[model samples]
Target chain A: MSTTARTVVELIVNNHPGVMSHVTGLFSRRAFNLEGILCGEIGNGTQSKVYLLVNNDDRLEQIVCQLEKLYDVKEVSVRDDYDNTIFTRLHDLVTNAQ
Target chain B: MKLSGAEIIINLLERQGIDTIAGIPGGSNLPLYNALFKSKIIRHILVRQEQAGGFLAQGMARSTGKTAVCFATSGPGAVNLITAIADARLDSVPIVAITGQVAHSLIGTDAFQEVDTYGMTVPITKCNFLVRSAAELLTVIPEAFRIAASGRPGPVLIDVPKDVQLQQIEFNTWPQPGKKEGLAYFDNDALLRAAAMINEAKRPVIYAGGGAMYSGISKEVIKLAEKNGIPATLTLMGLGLMPHDHPLYLGMLGMHGARYTNNIVHESDLLIALGVRFDDRATGKLAEFCPSAKVIHIDIDKSEIGKLRRPEVGITGDLAAVLPVLVDLVGADKREEWVKRVETEKQKYPWSSQNADDGMHPLEIIKEIAAASNDDAIVTTDVGQHQMWVAQGYPVKSPRTLLSSGGLGTMGFGLPAALGAALANPKKQVICFTGDGSILMNIQELATLDEHKLNVKIILFNNGYLGLVRQQQELFFEKNYIASHFKSNPNFTAIAEGFGIEAYQVDSIGDLKTTLPLVMAKDGPALINIYVDHTHNVLPMVPPGAANLQMIGG
Candidate 1:
């Protein structure tokens, strides 16, 4: 059986060479294999949304705390409202379809 | 009562006891750099990229145990720094990363040089702040430092919007007191139970981690381990937590752990894990690992307990706090049989290349480097086979003497990390141990070293290949050396010279002995490229998914 774990991280960054470089650099450094990453604009012109899927849930707490300390990062939340909202949305869609 | 965001940042850093800054400026952060031009209170290091700036901060933090700061501009510049920031967080180094954001109004309009840097770093920092208003600057700057330098120290980020940078605010005379309760506290009950378990076990072992070094509790850890007559083993990050030559020392324990250390871990009745997160690399096949032992896990992070392999006794507090209690409770008693058994094992598989009299082995090179340094120098290494060899062969006499990538295993970590260490502790000699493959990753840092004239010795173990990858290929892929071999490699000695660093090339053991002393004597940064046979391998490696005892070497 294939092994798997899940973690969610939110990043707030200023859009720009090495921003992606910095993020990818971190993942490689921590040896945290990313399952998936989704990013988008948020909060009216000042911030963006980054949803990271990491393989190690155990390290999420520390990872989240550390992420909050980066220069361009405004805040970092490991367990955000997005998970619940997504779950609720999925549930609503299933019920309405039925 | 007027100040630019950059001026406020420099002033805040000076207030927090930071005298040096490492960074590069881009269009977005130019205003701050302009402000820094007039400030003499803080020294700014103009690095080529923000990535190296972060690593330099990490090295400074690692050596000094103080929060080091780095800066960058928006877009790629800010992002380039994430690697080093995550490295600091994972290794528990106190670091502060400051990046310039594009104008707040253009954040979502996809303006030039605008990227979501704050969003990108959310997963790798302890806390981060976006300076939406100049009024918040005084409060946020000091808070970031407090958080980064506090218990279980790690990285913190502060993003300054361009508008905020151009605004003005009154500097506060006194910053708010940092959170106190969030800090870890030792429970007396857990400490008592841990002591009792150690007292009862016949074959007990102490597994120390980087926390011991971070807390400056190596002596306390050694005292407790010695009092109970427990054999001690350290994680790669925990190198120098105890003297490698100490009688109870069992070398590093992990995937490339010594054969006897792994065997003893398997046979022990009790294992005292201190400040170590049970990383998969350390505890191979966790279910089958140390099955007979009653585990006692002690760490500052409570979540680390019962997360991987459940421990019978979990003590969530600083190692510095609990180690003394353990020593006092468990009085000194010599376990002659246990000590004798470990001594016998040590004799059986000594960590040396005794048979190599003519050819230069990596282990021999590491030993010579350690011997020449007087055991008082600080040694750091980048990841790969060379890192393991250094961990296995170097006889460390003091704590905080060895710094290397443990959880991250970043390949190009050595040179930049050594630069940071050298800058942090100017009085002591610092050395960088790296493989030929790993060294090329950030070889440009040679310019940074030469610019500052740092006294860091770079020892490049050149085997004409990615030695670790080649070893893995040989062990797992039927010896099919595909892309692992590098046929036309740049002469590192010449490259160092090109970057203005003194360089040397050693081909034989005789040449190595003659050149090593000269390299050691140089007052500025120097690189010694040692060409070894491509056939050398790091031994005692455990096959993936196998029991710890089923190691390759004797």
Candidate 2:
């Protein structure tokens, strides 16, 4: 995780239908803020990868712990080395659309 | 073997050794009921409502520490189960709730009795599933049970579409029943560190929560306390873990705790937290609870370790497995000074039960119930003054005997839960302590109790008001009582008689003293509506957001 405020979280989860709801619902229920999100089905489509942008605050450990407990979530990792441009571009696009 | 999804569910539950199931049937779940009718091994108890079905399942699960099953149909049926499911989540009770939904083809068309059962239950359940096909039932049924009964147990939901239930599937062999998975690992280094901390701390306290109750490590906990000269206090959910009169026991701590107990906990230099989440009710204020104490928290769930107050040494493992090693690792300390201080605090300010001999006080009633009933008789309580009083006053001898809705604090929990306890333990007696307000919420379950005639007793603390709310309003809200009072209180005795159960009333303290023991001794299901003055309040309450030490009125 960066000393900076923003960090990226990557999750490998089962690609079952309604699995996304479990992942995203957990973030909302725990009151963790998700700044940006990107996801796609991995090879064979049996599993999917999700990336979430969030602040690297004190609650980050708790956020990761809660994610690890989800039944569908297979793996969780914090990535300090990531392309910030992608999330910034997405934010810009949404701002322009509005 | 060729079987429908409904048949598979029944067959699987029977294989899991689930003999009794409770639920209300609807058009969507008729197929399951049909399968249930054919299965001679499994008996179904038809609850008056779907929520009661879930709570009834909880009654069985909480009493036995086993996974219990309940069923409901879609829409309103699924909606009603939310409170009970959420309650289970808060208390970490293991129950599997299966609900029926409309056909898959309907999609979001909003057909009759259609609701997004899966979506609604995601936040409440430990895990949930929406069966896409009948074939999924083979894996899903067993998986649901496994998830529900696994470490840090909580409710799980399975929503099967009506068409899926009718869809037939052929398989070579039936799948095995679901079994609970044990703790995979715990850090030995952390364990040793925890032991050293306990050995060194001068004034230590063991604070047990629901996890301790579920782990069945009462003996180990007591050993840890006795060896280290630590005083122990239980959360409401952990009341029965320490015997009511254990020498090292300091009773409950936090909101509605005795002043001395709360004070003693806050004064501790070391807090050994076991399977506890440090909830607001038990901690009063996060910053102020056990402020001087460095904690050693052991829970099966990892997320709870630093969720509220961070612990110095947190061991993420089951207490049943963790405590035995912990008991041996710690060196003994007399802690004469700490023990003397605890005793002095307790002696100087005794609990209401210590002095009050009034026959009509809830404390006396609870003590009398303990006297009349055998040591192991199960007790359940609705959320209110009576529940708090029972937590403070009842002499619960063992774990799983005192069942109350701790986290959710839901009313109407007592009656259906009592029904479940009675059903699960037909040979043993079960008692429900409810108030006039609480009883009315699920009063319809009396019919279920009457039909079964299992030895269950309903003791109603009739105060003609929402007693707890009224008390809070009196203390915190300036006593401008509006909706708290039930001016036209229904005669519960008459209502019980109408429901075809034996009923009695005791208005005076003298009558209450004479009649309670005899009523408790009677054989079949009975209800005793004992009139209580509304002025009586559960004491030693710490107003919300205050420190545990700032307790008021006992």
Candidate 3:
């Protein structure tokens, strides 16, 4: 069995109707699947934070580079060393609820 | 001045210079249709299905390089347009899709004809809007057009609730259309570095893509290649960038590319990829693609520069702006020895067939079409063996004339898109090159063709099987052909006649030669069905998961 590492990509984008689609559609069009995604409106409600959990591969850097090119995307950063326990915890809560 | 939301939307579209729209009307969108009747400025072409409307808009946008609009009512009408919207997004075609919604008061109540349009379209559109009030329509209408046509163009959706369309608001002044801005950002240092790489390379190849044609910079790209005496190979989307007869032009390079072209790319020392994302189909088994070449990637979209393969120099700017600067810096130089080597490979594996006397060949039919049209016709194709055959056999002399579903590989795009192209360029001859299987996917659009009486010539390659899939199964699955063959196919000529289109059927080369000229001169829609050899396969095909150099059968 092979092991795959997961990394979180954090993005700050203008809070608008299609910003999320533009960001995520880029990955889907490239045939890259995201593991998990978390998003909500943040500071002053004008901007939103989007966290995308994706496999850590050589293609990750390229995906991050593409995310930065979006017109509505204010900033993008790859948080490789950040704690990923939040996803694991959420997964467990959903499984327990089911 | 007081105006209803529907009126405001129609007036704003007129301000954007939109004189034509493709759409269908339903209950939820009756108010907008009512407003459209009052205005004689916008001519609405009624399409039978909502999806065809979307592709019709795509045809106009792609053919003219302008923002086109399409409309659909709530529920299934909106949902049916999803495939075409996604196609536009993948291919970067600029289109605005206006969809109607249930009344605002019916939010989340599972009301009649109400579905989550905003939620369903978010992942497919460049941007989408769900207007809350009638006053918001003022800003949303113009913004949708702006976002759709702006940097790296794609489709945008605006879903207005029925109640908002009925509401009225007063405003003294109308919102002006936004000014267009260029997305390219010049970087001189990177240009110099790329120039230096070009000057030092012994074996260089220019890889051009769809973005080059989208930006109308094929002249600059061709100039750079000719100035440096470098051979150029186009991606599927970049087919018409260089004239087919240009000396330095190698045919498309990818899985189904010419054997010599793939060999040249593999042996090259430098690759100047412009506006091309190193897609997997274009670069079979990435590890071995351009193995010895150092890449210099340039694109308007920053992320595309280093997304696939890490380039030695990545310039994130417009090709129109960057290519000229790089050409000036590099100046003129010649690599005769490299050009000679490419010629040697081309001679070693010539694109000629020995089966011309056996039966009707698809390449012969394409060549016949090319001869009759003088290589100047706007050729759109559906995906499959026929698409590849057209790519190989047809000689495209100009850019934007060869339109196909490149990135998305969507079938059923040709017929409706040809309708759109014919409408955009009324004087130009448009031809739809499709296969038996693909033509049936959206055959309903024949009614639209009959209604408009558009002069679109349909060339159908009938093999009675899903040719590409059958070929794959024959090679990989030990000839276990299941669900690949048509037990009994319809008489396409009869079907075309029923649709009021002039029709002909050809089973031999002689028939094709005689029928082609007569059909070409015909003033209305015509369908020429050419039956091809069922066992004949596209040559020089690089199998999946293999390197470009590992192609079998030339």
- Residue lDDT tens for model 3, B345-389: 999988775346664678877877899973567888998999999
Sequence-dependent TM-score of model 2: 0.97
lDDT digits (tens) for residues B1-554 of candidate 1? 66777778777777777778899999888888888888878888777777888888878878777788898999898888888887877888888898999888888898898888777776677666667877778788888877886767878889998888888766646565333224447888878888888888889989889887887888988888778788999988888889877878888897888888888888888999988887777878888888899999987766667767788998878777778777899857799898888888877876553436645888888878887774578888988988888888888778777888777777778888888888888888998999899988888788889999998999999988999899989998999999999988888888999999899998887888888898887688888999888887788788888778778864
- Each model's lDDT comes to 0.80, 0.90, 0.88
Task: Assess every candidate by TM-score.
Answer: 0.86, 0.97, 0.92
Instruction: Give fnat, all candidates.
Output: 0.06, 0.81, 0.56
Error of 1 at B149 (Å): 2.1
Best model per lDDT:
2
Worst 10 residues of 2 chain A by lDDT: A83-92
Q: What lDDT does candidate 2 reach at residue B405? A: 98
Q: Of models 1 and 2, which has the larger lDDT?
A: 2
Candidate 3 regions with alpha-carbon error over 4 angstroms: A1-10, A16-43, A49-60, A69-72, A77-98, B354-359
lDDT (0-100) at residue B276 of candidate 3? Answer: 89
* Candidate 3 interface RMSD (Å): 3.4
